[model samples]
Target: MSRDTAGTAPASASAARTGTARTGTAWRRMRLWGLAHAVDDLYQGLVPAVVPYFVLDRGYGYVAASGLTLAATLGSSVPQPFIGLAVDRFALTRLAPAGVALAGLGLGLSGLVHPYPAVWLLVLLSGLGVAMFHPAAGKAAREAAGDSTAAMSVFAAGGSVGFFLAPVLATPVLVAWGVGATALFLPPALLMAFVLVRAGRRRAALAGAARPRTGTDRWAPFAVLTAVSVVRSVVFSGLSTFVELYWLRHLHASQLVGGTALACFLGGGVAGTLGGGRLADRFGLVRTVQLGTALTVPALLALRLTPGQLPPLLFALLAGAALNVPFAVLVKLGQDYLPTRPGTAAGVTLGLAVSVGGLVAPVFGLIAEHHGPQGVLSVLWAVPLLGVALGCFLVEPGPADQREPARTMDPAGRSR
Candidate 1:
């Protein structure tokens, strides 16, 4: 018995060490993918930040400038479903690096061009590039993340971080060097692209040749989740578009205070995104999402009802956090529901449906114009209420729904 026990102890220790090492490696890969996600999304944020410079420097009117915005939006948000389909069909491992490069190059060259048509086209192409990155990168991030919602949130939060950093980083450069400074941003993209390529090779070498995907796709639940996501998007976009205006006009705050409020709200989104993932790991994906969606209504109502400047700021932070708690959860759940079509699932959840809010922004604009920011805020709670309703239909993916591990092949084509 003693001899048998001694032999088993070392073997158990070896297995434990192996598991720990694998977990550590998985996290490191997730961090790299997260950084790549940040770099890709930084370009998304750059579009809005650079739009003002185009108006100031090139003397473009609001209409022409809006066309530029439209170009980017149409390019990025549209066709993502198609791109995702292509990714799943072809296994496009190269798309991540290629997409980021194209996104950066298009934006970088847009400012250097002279014609309005050329600038619009470049921005459009840049948007297309952004579209290209999400599905492929999302699938890859999933492979890295496995079943951990917390790990996936790292990728999701990276996007929020990139969006947050864009104006901060690009504003000073644009102010100093005009729009031409956009050319300077290209190098980072190029460098990151190279890094991604190398990372892909290494991951492929470690993971080996891919195995056929396993699991059944559940579209009905995915459809419900999409509705929930769209509702979340509209609420988030509405607040993001008009939160500052709400502070300035309704709360009677100064421009600086308004900006600060917006900052607080966005910053809370970052924190909430991270927190939601952790919560999902513990409380479950569907529950976390439902909780977040339900909480958003009260938080937005509180933000609207709060009278004092200081109190509203707190509520804004809460509102932002509450609304975003499902942001990453939805993405992960979409993949869970459609395990066989992760790229397509990601394209719809991350790119296509989320864009609905942006398209719906004009309606919110009309509302603000007619009823003021407070009126817009009043209507926003109803949006998430609908999300809460839809979320009730969201069934968690079962253990059998989990994806099978990929089979690795040696250079000689033998399974390892």
Candidate 2:
């Protein structure tokens, strides 16, 4: 009996060790997934910052340039839901890297093309490539993260870092070597593709070995989350596209001052993305979201009323923080809603919902055009209010209220 007990003890310890190893491996994969997302976001951010310069230099007017920018955004945004659907049906690990490679090719090819129409067409194609990256990458992040809000926060921060880096890194390259050197990013893009492919293979191997139970019904809660995300995106769009111009034109801020203000906003977003995730984990998703959304009001009002540089600067910082904090929380909430369908939830929340803002950007532009840029802020002020109303309707998930379970069925009549 003593010998038999000792033998069983060894078996139990071996099993525990194996579990520990698997957990560590999964954690590593999650970090890799986040890094992959950051790389794609870096490339995405680079395009907008650099493309505008190229258009202007090539003799495109504000309208044409705006059209090109919108075209790229539409390219990136419109296909997300479809991509989300595709990820549900197909293997996404293979799709993401392929998309990144195509985007790299598109960017490189765009450099070879001239005429305005060709440029727009290439931008659209590049957008398609970008579209591929988000849903697939987001899905990977969710799968790798399991149910951890901290993991989601880390993943979301990768994109925020990418966004911050793009302008800072790409601007100098464009200034020094012109548009041609921007293609230098292609090699890094290819390298990222290679890394993701390897990671996918590793995940596949692990999945085969573990034979974890497959989950279902991940679509319902995403629809509501998508609506919430759209409101957030609108606010983001108002800030990203118009904030600098608004400050410069309305408040008589210099170009430098305007740019600084925008930087402050993005910096705040970086902080918010990481902090918001932690907040979500601690306070519950609904509370975290409400906190972020509620703060947007005062920030918006401050921007609207403030006169001096310091106050506006402070407002920009606070506004940026409020704007970005909910991004990861929403992604986590979506995952919670459809605990079984992490990728699908990520696709809807991160990919489709975020894109809606680009669709609505022109409306904000029109408002700015008519009422001055200040009107744009006034219009944007309504978004958070709407979000707050929506927040009231949001049903918190079980226990910690960290997860957002699916509340509806798909078009296929499958309950989520």
Candidate 3:
């Protein structure tokens, strides 16, 4: 070979090594962001897990428990879109730490507060903290993951792990010490909030975004996606809110059995969220979502109708996986559908839109009050089928999208 060719080969090899190093560094950062996401969401899961305690120990009525759920749900979700819009204009990266800390602190105070109204206020504060974290953290995770659905899956799985851990970990402390044990759950959030504060110092994907597109909003697809997401929130949130009660009253189960049931469902969700990303990457995002939605009906049916506790518990795992596999993919798809406003997209999909389910939760409270917890759970069997019909209306972005750049940032944002 010529001397020029030999020299060029070494130079190319060096460039490859440097590129690989940068990618590796980015991935490590992404994992850390995932850890932050998990800790932030831990407080969210804690709200539901602690609900049973309020009902059983404190002798709170279904309406009162539902009111607490509404406060937390609305607090965490309603402010998200506005926060996303604000962060898009100016990166309030610090909001993430503040949000997590607020979530932890408010929840910690709940057990200490005596008045019912004050306790409700504390839960709302915690939910606001959750709302604060997602828009900023999600944009960071999107950048750090660099459009790798598998990496996004890892990030999404973190939240699932948090939700799964909430019941498993909280059940013991809560059972032993009552709702006042909420104070002990503060440490992880406090510590992680500091972790996020430091991590936010890193340059995020929004830093290297492309210029904004002037194209019209893709409201058609977005509306469909929102509808589907709302369905998911209702079913999943309903389950989280009621599953422990369902086990205790319906199946005559023990506390350990109850927590384990929740864990099985959420554990399945973690796996599904991770695997769903790969499935989306491999089979196409829309197709994978279709399968997941279709399966949700059968799994939930079996879970609801199964005679024995072990059998129903096993079905909960299936139901969790079938329902949640599309979640991370749906988030990514929303970014694609509205490429110009990815922050708003992230906010709606992650926060406001998803919270709609929680809005309807009081209806379930009424059902539980009148028809009982079994009736409430049984009614949810119809929700997944609606998701399926909605899925049918969604049009994929197309095969050409696979080879295009994955980062959903604008050129103007990238310059920052």
Give the higher-TM-score candidate: 2 or 3.
3
What are the per-residue Cα lDDT tens digits for candidate 3 across 175-206? 99999999998899889987776655543544
Once superposed on the true structure, which residue ranges of model 1 sit more than 4 Å away at CA?
1-26, 47-70, 108-120, 170-184, 204-208, 244-259, 305-311, 368-375, 400-403, 407-416
Q: Summarize candidate 1's per-residue lDDT along 1-416 as a digit string, tens digits.
A: 69999999999999999767854654565777778878887787677567657866998754565566567768877888999899888857689899899889999899999799999899889888888899988887776676778878988887766665665677678778889998988987898899888766766655535665689899999999999988887887677656766776788886557656766776687788888998998899999999999999889999888888878989888987888899889999998888888889988887777766666666766676678778889888888878888999999997833668445332222333
- Please give the CA lDDT of all the candidate structures: 0.79, 0.70, 0.81
TM-score of each: 0.80, 0.80, 0.88
What clash pairs does model 1 have?
none
Question: Cα miss at 416, model 1 (Å)?
Answer: 12
lDDT of 2 by residue, 1-416 (tens): 69999899999999999767754544454566667667777665655555545643576544454566576678878887788778766666678888777676766566566787887787777667778887777766665565667667878887777666665666566657666666777776688889878766656644423222244444555566677788888787667666766666788876456656666776688888888987887788878888898888889888878887657888888898998888899987876666656656677677667766766666765676578668888767778888887777776655534434333211112222
Task: Using lDDT, give the best candidate's number.
Answer: 3
